[model samples]
Target: MPDSFGRYPNMNISEYLDFFARAYGLRGASRREAVERVPDFTELGDLVNKPIDTLSKGMSQRLCPGRTLIHDPDVLILDEPAAGLDPRARVELRELIRLLASKLQKPGPDQLTHSHRAG
Candidate 1:
């Protein structure tokens, strides 16, 4: 699912990220929120709108992991998600991944808490 990034191959930064999320079943709203959280993401957002070939090596490197996460796969296999990101971006991305894992690990509050506590 390449979305605008892979599909149109000439989309703007915003369109790329937005479409990438949609292709992977993520809501456009959530994708925008997540991008906002990343440092200097506005620049990246702008880059996404441009031609993919216009991106520098580092920028292109950073975008790969972001697209991977937009889908929220059950088993994410990141070869090098942190490769070109700044330290802050890497840390932020790590926290996001941790949060996502936490979400997936926990059961519904009622079913999980009640069953565990009752026992």
Candidate 2:
């Protein structure tokens, strides 16, 4: 699936993101929203209008993960999410993963209250 990133090498960032967004059943505001966010999420904001074929290895590395994450899967299974990224991209990926983990682990207010009472 990682190699699928270049399937449409001529597609610009927005089109590439939109293609996946639709593939994952996103529509209307949600589809548009995901397309907009993916560039920033992948640190490709400045290259959003550029064709995918032109992206550097590090840029492509970040973009692939952003595609995988557009659906917001409950359990992500990445073999090597930052394999070809530079040190900076690796750090950013680590931070993104940590943020995702914290968000997934945080209990809702109702659950927090029940846990406190049970304890």
Model number with the top lDDT? 2
lDDT of 2 by residue, 8-114 (tens): 77798889989999999989997887788777756688888899888877677767767877766655555555665666766776566544334432331121111
lDDT accuracy of residue 38 in candidate 2: 71
Where model 2 places Cα greater than 4 Å from the true spot, the runs are 1-4, 86-88, 99-119
Model 1, CA-based lDDT: 0.49
**Tens-digit per-residue lDDT, 1-119, candidate 1:** 12123434666555666666677666656766654433133236445446656775556655555555554555555444444556776566556445444443233122111111111
Residue 17 alpha-carbon offset, candidate 2, angstroms: 0.3
Best by TM-score: 2
Per the 3 Å backbone cut-off, how many clashing residue pairs does candidate 1 have?
A: 5
TM agreement with the true structure for every prediction: 0.48, 0.71
**RMSD score of candidate 1 (Å):** 10.5
Q: Rate the local accuracy (lDDT) of all candidates.
A: 0.49, 0.66
